[model samples]
Target: MAGVRDPGALTSGQRTVMAATITASALLFSSLTSISVALPVIQRDLGISSSALHWVIVAALLPLCALAVVSGRLGDVLGRRRVFLAGILCFGAGSVVCAIAPDEVLLVAGRGIQGVGVALAVPLALANLTSALPGHRRGWAIGVLSAVTTGVSVVVPPSVAILVHFASWRWLFVAFVPVTVYVFLAGSRHIAESPRAPGASMDVRGCLFIAGGLTLLVFAFERSSDWGFTNRQTLAPLAAGLLLLVAFARAERRATDPLLDLRPLVRSGVSVPLTALAFAQCAVIVVTVYVTLYLQQVLDLGTIETGLLMLPTSVGSVLLGPVVGRLTDRGAGHHLVLGGMTLLTVALLWLAVGVDHRHGALLVPALFLLGLAVPLVYPSAGALSLGALPASARGVAASLQIEARQIGATMGLALMSALFTAVEWDERNARLADPAEHFTADEENKLDTVLTEAEKGQALLARLPPAERRKVHDAADAAFSTALNTTLIAAAGLLFLGVLLALGVFHVPRRGRRRPGP
Candidate 1:
């Protein structure tokens, strides 16, 4: 504990550790969305085909989500500090690779390397921060970390747009190299080493199973929207993923030092929180995806306006974070989580009812409620899940948290995609059935694909008479609105399920009593 300092006054060493870890967290999470904003620029610069553009996203996300658990266990077996430094190195190297990449292949490979680094760093950062603080202060610190990372996302889309507009897209990757180096140096100096499990060996078989399982699952979900869920490509991977995951569960039970200790899921009562996290994340992702699409396609908002409209959620979360953290520290984690879940459900319901081809700003109140709701549940649920485990297991516990949220996001994307696609297809068929429309098969097919794209849809209808075109445009808008409302209702239902799960797992401590730490 060379750099260790007492928690009182939060010494410079402690401050450095917090600053470094929090900065790393912000950078990593920013990558999740920023690359997407830069995708168009990347495609034009690298001559990347439209089909291959998605791989840019999948390349980074697949490894990040797949290897997260293994990375956490690695930190435990080796030293967290060692793994943390390694992560910084990998991410910095990958960013350098991306900046210089001349083709799509190298760019994608660089992204994959970055994913590996994220998988390594994110959980360890959390573990390190949790270890740095005394039990009483961990919740508040976590809240601040969560707040900054989530709040920064509000600015990321617009920032990336500005950066891409003013300079080369490659600069996006290059600009962060200095920050990465700083974090690495500062972390090496200030972040204390945590307990390395003596005699613990790497769970090689478990790692392979989980990495393969999760990668396949995430791949299947990401592709499901395009491949169709029932298509052989999707079903085959889905089955394989499920089988591999089952095998992983069996292997962990037998391993001397499992990569993931399932007992904690039940013993620490973390299963409930994990379940809540998953369902809550599902709802959150659905809102994010559909709401953005709704704003653009239905309400006819520009990219800048859409990004600006999304700010309420970020602002609400930032403002409410400290209060929620204080309440959680006061043994109100359970109540906060339940209340948050309830509010989330209500917000979703409001969005569902209010969705229309009207002013986009009307959604602001619900979005802000969503922002407030998220901070309450996310940090509290995280504390409830990780705080219940011993320090030695916190890394693995953090990995579990990350994995749950990622899986939830993947599932949400797939679910909403399927629902929305089905509605689109149904709407297309209904239009085709109308004899008065007199649509040809080719025209119907073109309309089917572009129903969600206002520009494309208008172009496709350009050959038609103005009256017919207007009718079709209005119909497409209505269909898109219906799809959005359906997804919102579905998200609301998922949040209700999360509320019930939270109720089962958490209980407020009596007045003047604090919940016991692990």
Candidate 2:
């Protein structure tokens, strides 16, 4: 059993080291989600179209997904500490590039560099925590890591939005540079270096296959709107991606030391948990992206106000995470997952029925429940999946888990954005066909700014005759309601699919321990 110790249990030196390391990890995770709040600002300043903006987000995610497995393999073949330090340096340099970027293309390139660094740093950080701590204490440390990384999504984004309101958006990247430097400096002294395994060669072929396949897949999703789902542009990439993935699976089977060992997925216990994890991640991203748009675009809230309205999600996750972690440690993961998914399903259904411009309050409880479900599901899924693998394969298992998450997030964003854009276009056309009885060209232009300034909208309306103003208001409200309802209904279907996958694929049998030997 682990003995009780001070919350600052490490020697002064070790405590500083741990603090620096964990802080850097938290910042990386936070920056990924926090940027959502600044999307409008980015679009305005950069003079980019919506499609181009979507590519900026996808650029960061694509490299993260493509390189995640390769980074883990390199860590195992090289040294975890050395690769981790390299990742930190690359990440800091990328931040500098992002801060000074002159155009959208350069910014996307900088973000791609940052993604490479993130792919390396994140998994190694988790693996390092496991190595530094022992037994049950390891579980607690992992819980703390999860809480920091996940909780930052709620805390950091809003704080950054406040900065955007007061200062320039470039300051967001500038703020991260100092922290990254501190982590690199402190990590040099405290973290023990893992020795490279002898005779382990990098799987170049396997890396190419997986990276090529995933790139094609994500590109297909990103361009599906413009290309049309059935057009040659879309079908060609989708088909090529599927073929390359098939080739990757075959190559992995024959490689002496594969980049991604497929053998683990063949095991019932490991496969089950991984499947559940993928679906859960997909559900979370779908809801988050749409809700953020709904709040800002449809309801006409400011960045800070939208972030504040999202507080219920952050609060629920922080409060319930530890209790769920304890339950998972006690071997109650299956039931916990079941309950969590059920709650998520209910929340999505509620949003489907109740979300609207006038009924903003109705969304709070549903968002809270959805947030509570995430922490409960995520850590438990991770623990169960890792538990099914041998101790030697822990690093690869961790990499695969993170890869699944990135893939889910990429797919969710791509799909939901397509849906929302389609709905928006349809509503825009409908309104144009029969301009609101009182709407003038001036009011129509003002409606575009409603996302940025609701007060301006009210002033514009006040200048019109009372009956005409009412007509304009009614039209805006109807459009918002129609778009929001369409998105929510889609979310409900996705969540229900997640629940079904969880029940069928992740249901562990009563008396059997997870199969060992990947």
Candidate 3:
């Protein structure tokens, strides 16, 4: 077996490989996030239902969540380079499919394929980096990876939105094709292939259970507004998904070589950091999705303006990441993690309380603070998670962390969407004069049209009389403010939970040495 290299003392060739891997990872992360700002346009062009629109943005996350552990095991059994290359191919192919997808169904299928590729790429990338680099160098490499991944999400999505303004939404997927091709070609030569461990088997059944469970759960949550939570269409899938997840847990516990080893999750070393990562990711997704909408819808900003507004997040992450990484390497993981989480919580609360139509300026500082907090939190969480495991299980551990991130993102979007929809509904209802006592049929029709028609919703107030317009504007503002606050408060709570989880799960005695490498 090839041994792990000392990251701190990497030869020039190894350093080159690390740089290439980080670049590849960054490209992939940028591709994943670049779609965020384009989502509204996609929804309009595709004529997709609200539920379908949600899936379009989040579908990639589902397979990533389900396949992560399995992909990690594949990395160990099939060789990391082979899996990594295959992932690149898959991602590129999926992008092509998305670029030409004729309808929502085809687009979603393409997105799911992309999710699989992400599942394969992300964990293998991390596993390869962790295995190739030595101690302090590993921390630094991971820091760079975290910074690039998180930073790109903040920067690239809005930039893509700017492109979408001048070009079609199809260009968003088209843009990735060249980058993917370049990364695949360049990385193939630079990265060494690790030999597969003999006698390892893929747990096909475990993969099925997890995939089915997550898909069902995600679908249920995505469609809850349309189908209603109590409807069989929603409840059945959700219940079945939960049952399958429970079955997956049972199967993993009993399997001789489980695809997803549940043992590590039970171990304090692994579980703590993983949970914190999951929660933090949830907060990030919620903030990202809503903030983009807030800029475009509430602030009436164009794509270019929105893109520029989001730049602070990326700038802050780039600045803070390396510093936090150094601190973690110097034995301050707990402090950095705690401080980052606290910053994130404060930012979310500030946004919730202070954000309004005239308060667009507040977004600048809030986003920048979040930018700073994310890099600090993510890299430390990743390093701590990987640090808890033996070398042999690093692939699985990395996959587990990625899976947590995916699940958190999916759940966060679903929850925030539900809140937004509910608030919007209430706002519409509030605008209706006492319907039980003196409502006109035209007023009821207008309200229904606002709720049902996406384009109509935007112009509803514009078409009303001046007196009525004031009422509609006030109601819309109230609704948006309420929804934004609710989501931000929820985000803040999640961040606080993340901090507590980190404190409990990631706590290592100051005098303790690193666990012996597997």
Candidate 4:
């Protein structure tokens, strides 16, 4: 091998290296979905308030959003393999702490640690993958990684549901212990060292500015629903974050070796795909959260069944993984992205209409199409992201791409939350305005307020007559469906925008395209 900096000079077997990296990648991705299944169990066991329980989820997300860019850059300076190993160590340690924590506070704190580890590892793994594999194989490798994650999501929930049903939420953390340990030990041997900038000075000020800015920015987005948008608590942090980010941009332009170089983002190859992926990801995340709610709350499906009902989401990744990857390898990355976005937009619109119409069958097919479309976008986009950067800058490229998607996820969740609250308020207000419903003043007052999950559950409706209970149930479900549909429509629009951006990203002429040989 010529040197460590040469990506074409990976020293280990590709399969073994990919196994290790993808295992670490899968571990982080699985954590995102499986935890939701155990949240209710955790709340009951820890005696945490319903409203406060959101902090547990936010605690994890906050660090992932805040530290992602810095961590990626750190990998470039320090070494991707070194960062990956350290991340696994942190993640394993955090899981143990989470498993043993006696209260919600400690558990949430443990998750914050885990999130830091995740922020460190995820991008480095992809960077390593894009580096180790040949250009043609990179897309296929990304496809396999995507499929592995989808497979993990499919397996984790029902299994966690069963574990939570029979045992404690603590066991959920225990499940990952052996697997992570195996990955760490084996990965030490298989993963190769990547190109790194040992002489580049760390951008400490840039790091601080970005970390503070993104943290506050995400904080403001999360709190905006509770505190009005115009509230000082919301607006002050947001404005300050914007200013810090502006300063950060200026600092990047002036830095000797910048934390984040803005120049790579100018190319259509990089800018278009990454930007489009962000909105596409926004649609997926919002849909997943709402659909899970729809299945459990609207359809009253049990935990295991709800998990099963959502299983079709994996099929797309399985089927599209090879095709999209090959297409990307063949210089059709942008074209595939356009197709994926179109599919997702249709899926979102389908779900919106079917959900509002209260037809359960339609949701299944829509989710299937979503499964198909999502994999197409990811592999193509991830390949393009790596293509946009030099081997030394892969870490930065991967992290920035993930960070864009992270921002999209945050914004999507916030938008849906606000929309749901508003629609629920309208539902409640309608009862006060209705004369024929004949709800008493006390009943109308209670109905006029936005209801919590517990308030909407069996206890509240138990005392009502059968007819009144049925009416209440129907109204609640209808209001939820309408709100969800509105969110879906908005998500569809986001995907449509993505389609346009993706087309621009892949604007190369077919005749000029270069293809790898057998």
- Highest TM-score among the candidates is held by which one? 2
* Candidate 1 TM-score over all chains jointly: 0.77
Find the 10 residues in a row with the least total lDDT in model 2: 445-454
Please provide TM-scores, in order, for all candidate models, with all chains considered together: 0.77, 0.84, 0.82, 0.78
Whole-structure CA lDDT of model 2: 0.71
In model 3, the clashing pairs are 6-134, 7-134, 391-518
lDDT of 4 by residue, 195-281 (tens): 788674678998888778876776676566557678999899899989998998899889887777766677666778777777877
TM-score of 2: 0.84
Steric clash pairs (candidate 2): none
Clashes of each: 0, 0, 3, 0
**Model 3, range 1-518, lDDT digits (tens) per residue?**
36987445778756766766776677775665567676655655665544355677587888777777777678878999889878888988889999999888999888878877877886688777777776667878886787667666666766687789998888888887887787687668767889888887899999999889888887787667666788999899999999999999999899998877777787776787777777778877777766776666566677778778777667766677668778888867767778888999998887886665448887788888887887777778788777878888786787687778888888777767776666655665666553312344433333422322355444554556666655655565566567777878888988898787767655554457557485
TM-score of candidate 4 versus the correct structure, residues matched by position: 0.78
lDDT of 3 at 480: 58
As for TM-score, the candidate ahead, 3 or 4, is 3
- lDDT (C-alpha, whole model) for all candidates: 0.73, 0.71, 0.73, 0.72
Candidate 2 local lDDT, 202-228, one digit each (tens): 988887888888888877876775566
- Work out how many backbone clashes candidate 2 has: 0
CA error at residue 330 for candidate 1, angstroms: 3.2
Model 4: CA > 4 A from native: 1-22, 37-58, 72-82, 97-108, 124-150, 181-197, 385-396, 432-475, 502-518
lDDT of 1: 0.73
